[model samples]
Each structure stands twice: as C-alpha cells, then as structure tokens.
Target: MGKGGESIPDEEWERFLREAEAGVEGAPEEPSARARMVARRLREESGRPEPWRGHPPARRQRGKGWYAFGLLVAAALLVVALDPGLVAGWFGGGGGDGGSAPLAVESKRPDQPPPTEAAARRPTVGQPFRGSPAAQWGDGTAGIGLPEARATGWMDKGQVAQALEKSRDFLVASSLDPGVLRGERPRKAIALINPHQRDVQDYLATAFRAPSRENDPVLLFSRFDRTKVRLVGDVVKTRGRITYREGKRGAVEVTTDVTYVYPAVRAAAGSDEVVRTIVRREVVMSWDDPAKVITEPGTFSLVSYKADTTNGGCATPTGYFTPEFGPERAASHPADGAEVDPYDRSKSMETRMREAGGAGCGTATRS
Candidate 1:
C-alpha cells in the first residue's frame, strides 16, 4: 500500500530501487532528454495538491517502500529547485557545447565600463599606442613576413621565392619606410615595378607631383602630412599576410594584404594629444615569365591596388593623409558611407571594396 490508496507489489518495488540505484551510479555527465523529461515531470507532480492529504487514512497500512519513494522524489525536486543551472544543463541550455556558461546568480556583479570609455581613460602622452590593438602587433617591416614559396605551374621555386621577396620589399618601402610615410617618393618601391607599365609609373609621378581627387598617391602608399602631424614614436605597428598564386599567361601573382598603424600628434608645440591613423592595403603584383609573357625579366608589374584609411579626413584632395583629431575636426570632412571596423581583418579586401562601392568617405567605427 502506498499514498492515494495505490498498491505496489514487493517484487516491483525492489526492482524499481535497484534500477534507480544503477541509474544514479552510471549516469552520464549530461542527462539525456528522457531523463530530463522524467525529472521535470517528477518536479511538477511534487508541486501539485495531493488528493489524499487530510483525508481519512486508507484501510491498508502504508509500506516502507512508499516512504522511500517519497524521499527520492523530494530529494530530486529539492536539487532541481535549488540549482536551476542543473536543469538547464539537462536541456542543452548550459555551456556544455563550448558556448558561454550561465553565471551563478550570486557571482554576477555590476556591469563594467564600455570598451570606448576604457580606451578614452587611458593616458596617451608616453604610451601612444597603449589602448590600441596595434600595441601587440609587429613593428615596421618585421610584420611583412613571407609565406613558404613552392614551384607552381607557371614558375620554379627559386623564381617564386624571389618574387615573394620583392613583394615584401615593395610592402616595406610603400608602407613602413619613414621617408615614404613622410610624403617622400618611394623610389625603391617604384624601381621594383615593371618599367614597361608606363601608365602606372606615369600615374605615380602625377600623384606625387600634383595630387588630385582622381590620382591620390595615398591609395597605393601610406603617407602623412609632415607639416601638420609628427610621428609619436619611431616604431610603426604593422601586421598582415602575403600569398602567391598562378595567374593567366604563366605569371606568378603575389598578393599582399597589410595594415599599418601610425600614431601621431600635431606638430604644434602645445598639442600633446595623440591620434592614430590606420591604413589597410591590398596590392597585387605579378612576376611574368619572359617566354610566356612580354614583361621585364626581373621586375614585377602592379596589377591592382586598394586601400582603406581610418581616422583620415573624408575626401581630402591631398596625396598625404589628414588625420582627424576629434569631433570638431571630423565635422569639417563628414563621412557618408557605412561604418567600418578597421582592425577587423577577417574579411578580404575585395569583399570590403564591394561593400564600400566606389571611392567615398566612410565612418570609422573606431580608431
């Protein structure tokens, strides 16, 4: 005899206890769906009003098995009520699958400040790149490390290696060289390009001598106006990757995707505020096989170039980048396109270019 005038045979009760004990000892870390459902049902039934409560006792005497069963149900319900996370874990709501786990109620505290606020609070006088992600990046040309070169269908391993080395040199000259950054001609970089590509050379000359909105040298090289801003430190933080693949006409095409972070302050004596300009560039250079393609023997030809500059004035018609210091300065050259996260390099340059449409000013989500 059990509660509510229910009767359970002694043999069935003994079998139930044996099975329950085995389940308790051999259960997996995470409960299965059936186990969760059973636990949930037990919890719900324990909460319901008992029909036999306060009624006259049944004719049959209650057995010890009934009390044991009641105790097991009470214990399970207590555990489920006390630790909600236990229930969540049973239903895949916990962080068992590499997701963030639910924090205990007692462990939670007040929210901290936002990332922007924390960044703004950091000092910049002696630590120009302190709060920036570029702080951990490589300095100058060291970041432009080449990948392992292998022989492709178009070129031998030695040729591929030379082409990669030349591509690295071009990257260092165009982006990391101090003279190039200060609006000087990237002579070394230009010399590496194929001389037969007269149009590119002509464009570079025009871009340097007289820059216009159409032929801005900043598109290919990273430069800043020396008259307005001075570099904070000798080190320019840089990081990115270089890759090569076989192209049409038996040419080995090397592609460089690099980002440079330059920290600067106004040249004026009183200005101690440090501002950073981030430039991300993707350039494609091709080494043409002399027999298969009509190109310079040792030099590479520039196929395409694209760049995105963050913290630069929007649509400024100068060869050098004009860094925006604050809201007052940014207001003068208002950005007009989608917000960009300059530090995020997960997407390719082509994808970003497509998202950006043609050349127009875009707001930087951060510096």
Candidate 2:
C-alpha cells in the first residue's frame, strides 16, 4: 500500500525501484547545480542544525526495502535535477503549458479543511492551489466585491459610491498589485490618500524611507522579497467586503476588511515548493463633507489601518513578508501567541487582531 493506504501494483513498484537504482548508479561524481540546489532545500526542510560534510553519515543495518526506498528518493531528486521544468510544472508554471495533470478544485466551506487526504497533499506543479482555502476564491480584483452604495446621513449616493470605488482601488494597489507584491513602492495607493492628513503622510513617508518594526511598510502594503521568492501564479486569491457608514463630524467612513493569499516559491531556478502567506488588512478611510470640513477634494483621509499576517515568519523585520515554507521554518521562527487560523474569515478583523495580540507574531493553525 502507498502512504495514503492506496493499493500499489507490484509491477509498478518494482519498475520504480529498478529505475531508481539505475539512476543512482549512473549519477555523476560531482552533483550538478540543480542537484546542489535540491540538496540544500531538502536539508533545510529536514531541519538539521549541523552542516553537511562531504561524505554521507554511517549507515545502520536496515531492511533491504528501506535501503532501496532511500535510493529511490535520491533518484527522484536526481530526476528533478535533470529536468528543471518538472518543478515548474508541479507548481503551475506561468504559461500553463506544462503537461502535468491538474488537480480538481475541491469544494468545501471557506473555513473548512480539505475533505480528503489526497486533497490535503502539498500542491504539485499542475495543482498549485491544492490543499488551500484559496483554491475556490476569486482571483485578484474580482474577489474584492464592492457593496451597494447608498446615501449616508452626510454624503450623497454619488459621493458614497465614489468613496467605495476609491477604497477598492487602494485595496488593489496595496494588496493585489504585482508591482507592490514584488516590493516596489505603492505609488498609486499612496496617491489615493489625502495629503491634508499630515500625520498619515508623515507615517507613510517614514515607513517607506526607513522601515522599522514600529513603522513597517507591510502594515499598509503586501510585499515580498523578490530576490528570495517569486509568485507561483498570476492569481492572488482575495476575499473580503467593503462597507461604508456615517462617521463623526458628518463624514462617510469606508472600511475594507480583506484577506489576501499569496502562493510563492523560491526564486532559484530548480526550486518548486510553494508556500502561501495570508494577510488580512482592515483599513478605514473617511471622506469629509466639503462644506463641513476642509480636505483633499477627492482623496480620502486615513482613519485607521490594521493587518494580521499568517505563515509569515515571526522574526520578519525587513518590511517584506517572510513566507514560512514548512514546519522547520516555523520552528525556527517561533511565534509568541496562540495558533490562529488564517482561512477562517467568520470573525471580524478587529476580533482576529485582538486574538493575535496586536503587532506580535502568532503561529497559524494552517497555511
């Protein structure tokens, strides 16, 4: 039986063992660049603290099947080394022309886990979204659906609609834009903010110019280190709502509470493993009635901004998000708070943030 208790044909297993043994025997004395990269990744995944020596560790007596299985694993890695495209195909290549079989998108409640073991497996080249809550989510801007706008106590229906549209634009620019995701300055998002709000302007300027733990740019933008990782696909799964209500002093406050899921893999050529980072941002922007208050004619002033990041490492201090690839990475960057489920959007952002213990890292129940 296979790991998941599925029956494996005797002939197929024997064929695999024979091929793996042959590959191992024919491997070159010096590992190729691809092989080295794969080896490094495996080592990292293994969570070993010791450095690798030139020679393999002393082997102990074990069943022949176990020994052969080890060889099979090594041979599989060798196959990956020989064909870099195999890795790309496993994680949904940019062109989608790879010949790997894609997994069906599983149907489940947004807060529920994968229904079957097969559905819970790590995503393959053809099924990059498998095992994720985001598999069924709408892509990018399409997911940020706007609510029906109506006249507030102070603002007209047109003005309310404008405010909602502007809020949506800011969410796209800050969270879903490819340029912003690749760590570029969010110029378009910044442009939407009211300049008359000096405090917000100053805060943003400081965050961009000299980011620190207190003034991290990630609080406003979803960014990653381009040098370290690249997005798996063009799609960024998003789900959230935009709401507007009457605020103090005759202003219309628009609040966007959205969660963004990003799938990424190491930037290296042969690296194929995909890891996801979840960011939930709640931003409040208000437009004051022109007759009641002096403000930027069309721009909205920042009222409040809060974000909760999951599967991003605890010690991430570079402003760019650090994706935790596996349990080893999570162990290395142990969070201080309780495990929070990133996929559960039932609770309000404020409640989730409160549960996460504000500004501190918390382990995600699942990616």
lDDT, candidate 1, 1-367, per-residue tens: 4556566565765565566768866535554444455567667785654442147456454556688889999998997777654454466443221112322221111133112312222326576765555554666766665788899757889878888888888888888888988878888888888888889989988998888877888888878888998888788877677887888787888888888888888878878888888898999988887787667766888899988888765655688888867665656544556677787776778877777766777777766
What C-alpha lDDT, on a 0 to 100 scale, does residue 266 get in candidate 1? 83
lDDT value for candidate 1?
0.72
User: Compared with the true structure, what per-residue lDDT tens digits does model 2 show for residues 227-317?
Assistant: 9888887888777777778987879988888888888888888788888888888899888877777687778888999888876556737
lDDT values for all models: 0.72, 0.74
Lowest summed lDDT over 10 consecutive residues: which window, candidate 1?
Answer: 105-114
Residue 66 accuracy (lDDT) in model 2: 85
TM-scores vs. true structure, each candidate: 0.65, 0.67
**Would you list the clashing residue pairs of candidate 1?**
none
